[model samples]
Target chain A: MKEFNLIQRYFTPASLAPDTLLGVGDDAAIIQPPAHQHLAVCVDTLVAGVHFPKDTHPRDIGHKALAVNLSDLAAMAATPRWATLALTLPEHDDTWLTAFADGFHTLAREHGVDLIGGDTTRGPLTITVQVMGHVPPDQALRRDGARPGDHILVTSTLGDAALALAQWDHPNPAPTLRARLTRPTPRIAAGHILRGRAHAGIDISDGLVQDLGHVLKASGMGATLQAGALPLSEAFRHAMGDGTNWQYPLAGGDDYELLFTLGEADVEPIREQLAGQGCPATVIGRIEAEPGLRVLGPDGAPLTLEQGGYSHFGN
Target chain B: MKEFNLIQRYFTPASLAPDTLLGVGDDAAIIQPPAHQHLAVCVDTLVAGVHFPKDTHPRDIGHKALAVNLSDLAAMAATPRWATLALTLPEHDDTWLTAFADGFHTLAREHGVDLIGGDTTRGPLTITVQVMGHVPPDQALRRDGARPGDHILVTSTLGDAALALAQWDHPNPAPTLRARLTRPTPRIAAGHILRGRAHAGIDISDGLVQDLGHVLKASGMGATLQAGALPLSEAFRHAMGDGTNWQYPLAGGDDYELLFTLGEADVEPIREQLAGQGCPATVIGRIEAEPGLRVLGPDGAPLTLEQGGYSHFGN
Candidate 1:
């Protein structure tokens, strides 16, 4: 599709918060900072050969880029307001640009986010999306808020994306497993519901076990997760056949779901509220005043594991 | 020059606006959006093998990436508040990361922009920077404000970047031309100075002749320029040997400067004030009542050219 055609078909007529004075199709985006809120902005980059395989579909690449940034916003409990997309394409293949723009615009609209402004240039195929969200003046959620007695809960499942990537081309892998790898959904609505309820939160992009370690470091607390209570999709169970692939679920990356902590009194009520929306929540662990994380089996014994999640610069 | 060392040495100590609550070295940077000012945001991406050559120094790559976005802030005449840098690298080379951070932090500090938040991922050598600038509630500079008789003027010289890139490997082109290509400074101070004084402005990233086309299209005005008056550095003259590489000057892509239009009455006074700061100002064209651009020769004849400037997707 042509550039203007793609924009009109996928990006126009969206409902942004009252503060977003102007949306997409402009030289720059203009936002009226809310009366008592501060804007939180972040950017994420996904390169063709490094972030994803060269042949990864354009739509998936587009979705994951925005999904990751939205995940950052979720960690802060910030309500996303606007986004700017900076896309670098090797060539202007109509089909690819059309699919990419469709995926990006659809996600933005679903989250009530506006596509304000960005730049497009010729180069290796890479996508960078910058997201802006709003948080109440003094109440922005942070990784530093977990307390000694906080309940550590993860929304949805963990390690599904990692499992999917491993079996992507494996013979006879079920369709459900492949979907986990290709179309992992970002929990935007759940994130919105989570605000004000969670003390500290973060989206699990890099395996649940590894990313939570960051939370532990930042909050100065340790965590204990009951392995049996760890959410696992059916696909993950099937892919793990003899359970040898279990490490994939604990250390894989690219699951854009939120991992958060809440006060003990707030857990059951929040779970009930989430169930009302068809997304029953799970409490997998608890934060201790200690300084490290330990995963436990049903018998309360430590579950020994070798690998952690993927690290960008870690060897 | 390890990545950690580079960040600590250069980026950590940079000055920041009073509202920058936390800067760099975190999962995400936090900022205090000024009480009454709105935020203007934009993102731009540059990729090796697309935006620049793969062999280009990491330092220059870092500089250009941030410089491009600073130009966007200049377009709105917004005071840059904070920036997020998302870099995708192929490996964890300490020296490369250090050089890149040095360039990024230096330019950011010079413009009073703070590095608030960002993500680092393993991928192609790609850089995406999202910059946020503050404007009073209703006072952002825009592209849609040129009047019928506003005079159009460009800051610094044009085409120098395009020329520089063309001769990037030349043993030694003129010093000015090489600097323009390797490091075309963004008009950060000039942009703030022009706020409330100019009607509309935009940074010249594409090319003088083409980028100005955006302003013309947005403002619904035409422009006329005296051929000999297009800003030309002595380096530009020396690089093109016979001055025939005008295409590099007119269509080159790396110069991060500003192209703005102001009221005819406001021109002389603004120029005089800028001159006091040692920044030479030039008025090369005027906003006309008609609908397209024209470059005039010495005898008042239209100076026609084979091509206008560089186009991202254009062949």
Candidate 2:
């Protein structure tokens, strides 16, 4: 199939939002921005082998590609409106395209995002998704608002993705663990609830310690994360017997959970709000007046990790 | 260097536009869209070897990546605003990054575009740029407005870039020709002038014939072009004595010029306005009531080209 036909057949779905003025076949998609709102924009790229295993499902690749970008918008407490994809594939595969589009459109419909525009080219497999959304200017969550004595919280359990990756090549890998790595849930509802409640926010893609480090650095504050307080899923705890695999949650990457800071007085209320929405929030750390990160072990002593987090290039 | 540090050092230039509330460092950039305007968004991807030769300069790659996306925005008659880049590189090279950033930022500054936010990852060389701009809702140019009697116009020359590619492997290619292929100028100014006057518009990145075919298909009109009226640059004419190579202009891709349609009455005024801005336009054809494209040779008879245009997959 030709480039235009492929895009039309696979990516162009009926518009879900009314704000898209000119979608898909145009040189550019014209979108009507809602009045009195700030537009949140983010782009993320996923390479075939670098970001996921070569044997990964095409549907999963498509899902993860959009999921990661939406996670960024979720970090900013933005409601997704539109997304443009730039997909480079080795060649046109009908089955692959169908499955990929199914996965992408499924999540996009759930979030009410329109696939407005995209480009398809011939090359090694690579997917770049740019998601645009809107958030109230006054209520947009940022990473520079953390204050001393604020409680740092996260949505859902962490490190399940990393643990899944570790067992990806195993003969009998758990399907639930694999699902966590391949299809991450963007915490859009959690982000919406934390908009006015959370002082600072970031999505934990590069593990808790490193992602939290970004929040601390941006806010110019320190943080103390309780090792025992880091929520682990039953799957993770059962797989990691003896319950001492702190590195996965601390320094492992690819967790699409939201990490935010709430004022001490607002923590319980925000947590209850998130729980009511089916996504529970856990207070794993607290912001401090100092300017460095420290993790308290189960016994309440300082703990150091062998490695920080996943960086594209080694530091 | 780590991914974050590389982005900070190279891609994170000081913000130029005041509308950017948050840029570069955040999970997502926050921008305040101007009221009473429709946002135009588009994305384009460039892969090494597929889009450009492997030996192409890093600076050229960077310039072309942004230029192509800007051309799409230009086609929509949108004033350029913010852009997000998703760059996947094979490895870190300091010199390449410096030159690439210089080329990218230079063009971005010229167009008053801010590098709002992006993601950097390690993989085969690929660059995906998503650009967002704005235009008055009523004045936004589209590909579906051409009338039966409208005149088809194109900005600047068409085949220079294609001719440059033809001579790319020569011992000493012309610098001007090489520049045309490497850094074709985007017709943002022409697009601005065509906003309220043009019937339909598109960028000639996939050759004039193919790109104009899109306009015809969308507008539900046919077109007849005078092959002799196709504008050729002086260098192009000088290089080909007794020129009969119509394929270069008709079927060659990578010409980042605007191909638009204007009513008979608006033609001269729009041409003068564009020429006043230092970009000249040519009347190549006229829209017809028929439903197919026809090219008349200098002898006034119909001409048939060997190929239609470049497609990602062979037709």
Candidate 3:
């Protein structure tokens, strides 16, 4: 098939959102940003074998590519509006393209984010997603907003992706854990709720400790995370046996959940509200004036970690 | 070195444009788009060996990655503003990073597009650039706007890049021709000038024949081309041996010049004005109500070519 023919066959059927004035066929997509709102833009790249295992399904790759970008928007309290995908494939495989498009179309429909314009090239498998979103003036959640004494919280359960990763070699693994690893949800709605309410935010694509460190560093503050309070899922606990596997929740990455902060006076109400919206937010730490991440054990002592996060370059 | 540290050391030095509310390091970059202007977004990916030669310089790779995206914006008559780069490298090489960033920074500075947010990863070389620009309502140039009897025009010269490609294996080559091949200038000024004047527009990434096909398909029109009227550079003629190498201008790709259509009345004056702006427009064809491209040879007879243009998956 021709390049245009391939794109039209696989990527054209997905419905476009109203904000996209002109879609894929145009040189550039024209997007109507809402009045008085700023456009929040971010790009994320996932390389096969490096970012995901080579055996990973094409549909999961498609879902994760856009999800990671949506996670970025959620971290900024921006409502995803449109996306452009630069997809580099090994070759034109009809079966893979169909499954990939299906995965992409499903999540995009749920978020109402249109795939506007992008390019497809022949190469080793790599997917890059550039997501655009809108945030009302002064309502965006920023990393620098976290102040000393602010309470840090995370949405949903932690370490499920890592738990699934640890069980990758197992012939039969828990389906819940595998789903978390392959198709983690981006908490865009929670991000919308936290706007003007959450002091700082970041998505936990990296480890909770590492990502929170980003929030701390950007805010000129530090964080003291409570190990006992980490919302590690029951599936993760059962999968890892009775032994404490704090490392999974603390240092393992790939959980696309939201890690944010709220002030003392604002924490409870917003937490309840987000919980009502199906995202259970658990307060796990407090921001401090000095810089550094201090993860406390259940007995309130500083815990030692063999790894901080999944560093792309470092072992 | 850590991935974050590498990014900070190399990719973070460039000064941001004032419109960038948040530049790299944040979860997402927040840009304050100009009021009443719609965001024009486009993404382009350059994979090593596919988009450019595997032996191509890292600097050229960097330049072309972003240049292609800028070309898309130029086709839309949008003012280039901000860009996010998703860079996937096989490994962290400091020398290559410095050269790549230098090339990227130079073009980005020239275009006044700030590097806002993106991710770097470990993988095969692939540079995906997503560019966002601003276009005033109803003023954005579109491919679907061509009308019957509209005069088709192209900016600058064509076939130089293709000629250069043909001579890639020559022992010695012209420096200027090589630059044309490796670094085609995006015709942003031409797009800007053509706004409200040109009826339809497209960038010559996929050659005159194929890209014009896009315009005709979108506009529900056809085109009749004058093969001899094609603005093939004199340098191209001198470089080629005596042969009917008209396919260089007719079917070769990656020229990065603007191909557009304007009403017969609106053509001349705008052509003169664009010439003053350093982009000389040449009318090579005319839009017809019928569908399909017909190229007339210098002998005033219809010309037939085996290939229309470069298709990644086709001959």
| TM-score of the B chain in each candidate versus the native B chain | 0.90, 0.97, 0.96
Output the lDDT of residue A118, model 1. Answer: 69
Q: Please give, for residues A46-121, the per-residue lDDT of candidate 1 as tens digits.
A: 7776667677787877777787788777767678878877777777788887777777777777778787776676
lDDT by residue (tens digit), candidate 3, B131-215: 9899899999999999999999999888888878888887897777778888879888888998888999999988899999999
TM-score of 2: 0.98
- Candidate 2 on B198-260: residue-level lDDT in tens? 989999888889888999999999999999999888888888888559999898889989999
Candidate 2 global Cα RMSD: 1.6
Candidate 2 residue-wise lDDT, A157-183, digit = tens = 988899989998999998888899999
Would candidate 3 be rated incorrect, acceptable, medium or high by CAPRI criteria? medium
- Candidate 3 regions exceeding 4 Å error are A1-3, B1-4
Ranking by DockQ: 2, 3, 1
Weakest ten-residue segment in model 3 chain B by summed lDDT: B1-10
Q: Which stretches of candidate 2 lie over 4 Å from their true place?
A: A1-3, B1-3
- What tens-digit string does per-residue lDDT give for candidate 3 at A220-251? 89889999999988788888787878998998
What C-alpha lDDT, on a 0 to 100 scale, does residue A296 get in candidate 2?
A: 95
Over 4 Å off, model 1: A1-18, A24-27, A49-56, A171-173, A238-244, B1-18, B22-28, B238-245
Per-candidate RMSD, Å = 3.4, 1.6, 2.0
Ranking by TM-score: 2, 3, 1
What's the CA error at residue B214 for candidate 3, in Å? 1.0
Candidates in order have lDDT scores of 0.72, 0.89, 0.85
Ranking by lDDT: 2, 3, 1
